[model samples]
Target: MLEKYASFCYDQIGSYILDSLDYFEDIRPHLSKANIQVSLPEYVSAMVLSSMFVSITTLTVLGSILMIGSGIAGLIYGMILSLISGTLTLVGFYIYPSIIIKSRASKIRDTLPFATMYLSTLAGTGTSLPKLFKVLSEVDEYGEVAKEAERISRDIETFNMDTNEALKNAAERTPSEDFKNLMWGMNHTLTSGGSLRSFLRERSDTLMNDYRRRVEEFSETLSLLVEMYITVVIVGSIIFTSMSLVMTTFSPNMSTGFIVRLQVLSIFIGLPMISGMFIVLVGGLAPGGIR
Candidate 1:
């Protein structure tokens, strides 16, 4: 319903998107890769998201100011928060399609070696390029990459595009660099009279080695991150807590409110935000499977 409303907003609102077309051209490929269903023009999508977030943020800031404090200063502060929040919301909406593309790309990259191995094995049987993809597309075992191949096959068969054109389309829209390169390589090989099977097999082997090297490097980075987390969270928190306690113990005249407030601030405000940052970091680094 909210999605419909946003689209409606795009349609009913005169197009601010046309004036900002260049700002969103880079996102068009990602939109297809991410499978976002937007009937509106790319520009319209951006406009709708920005407008909606700003509207919501305005209401939220007004409510907060009314409920919590009142004055010119409060209004200014609230507007500042609203502007920041709204900007971030617009940024998130803008990047969300790209994020989805990257996620699918990660999943595709993780399984590219296996997918290539499968393709190589089929190519070895002397299957033509079109037939190979047509067969590959029917096999759901490769997951999202297989689905992508289906699109390629559909373009070639249903839309009457040539093999080269379909492959080019696939390469342009795929989130996976591996997949894009593979398509381009295959297309070039098919065009230039090279052996497709050997190319696929060699590519599969290379992709497998690359995946292994990345996993090892990622593991090493993870170890360093673990050490950093321990130092920052466990050691830092313990030290901070101890200092607070020691200060309270030594100062006989220390106010209980200040001591309690210090504890609350450290635990409630600091810890959750630190943990959240690490969580986002870990998730961003996590790409796909071990194999």
Candidate 2:
């Protein structure tokens, strides 16, 4: 498979090209947040080398085939074409990791409210930091929250890090602002000898209230949308149909059969489109769920 081959290529030959790139420092932090298993330098190097190889090969073949009888201008055109294609590929390669990070962040954000509530509940029991994280990691219902907790546990146990250090590292690497803030709060509470239970309880309550407010706002918006849909799609569609029928009746050139059939087509296609737009709008604006 291409994936296996790409992995092999990165492992075997990618590091060799890393010294040539100057942006390794800037890219290192993103690699952590993106959950990419590869080193930043190696990834960039592999991408650069692969893109170069592809560009060179494309230029050679296309130039030879298309510019056989042409002069330097033809060769230059081929190079330009190949360079553009290769540059697009390289850009996509770099952007793919950021996309992954965004998706992960979205999932984390959605599940954060419930996870905080769970933490607040556990904190009230006077649980130790490691045990609290272990319980969180073990719970399968929390989705990304559980996965992130597992990573935190692994850092503490495998890396032999203290609780505060582990939390700080997690905060640094997590793509979710909500999760980062939670970890920072926990870290600060531990360091300040403050009450973790009260902090988590208050934070969880805030998230719950914010989530409820968003849902209430969405309900109000949905009511307005329903009225709009009736006015614009339903009644408007009926009025248009009536007008078309009237036109067909009055005009000798217009066909009733054609107008009715067109109305039928609009009913099927246009009605669904109007409904789908509302669905998309609600989905885009809905508060992320704690799932």
Q: Give per-model TM-scores.
A: 0.72, 0.77
**Worst ten-residue run, lDDT, model 2?**
1-10
Which lDDT tens digits does candidate 2 get at residues 30-123? 7778877776656776677678778998899887776877878779888987998789878877787788788888777767888989998998
lDDT of 1 by residue, 78-140 (tens): 677677777777677678887888778888898889889999999999887888889888877
Q: Against the true structure, whose TM-score is highest?
A: 2
Which candidate has the highest lDDT of all?
2
Candidate 2 vs. truth: CA RMSD?
Answer: 4.5
- The runs of at least 3 residues in candidate 2 whose Cα sits more than 4 Å from the true structure, single-residue gaps closed, are 1-6, 9-16, 45-86, 254-261
**Cα-based lDDT for every prediction:** 0.80, 0.83
Model 2, residue 288: distance off in Å is 2.7
Candidate 2 has a TM-score of: 0.77
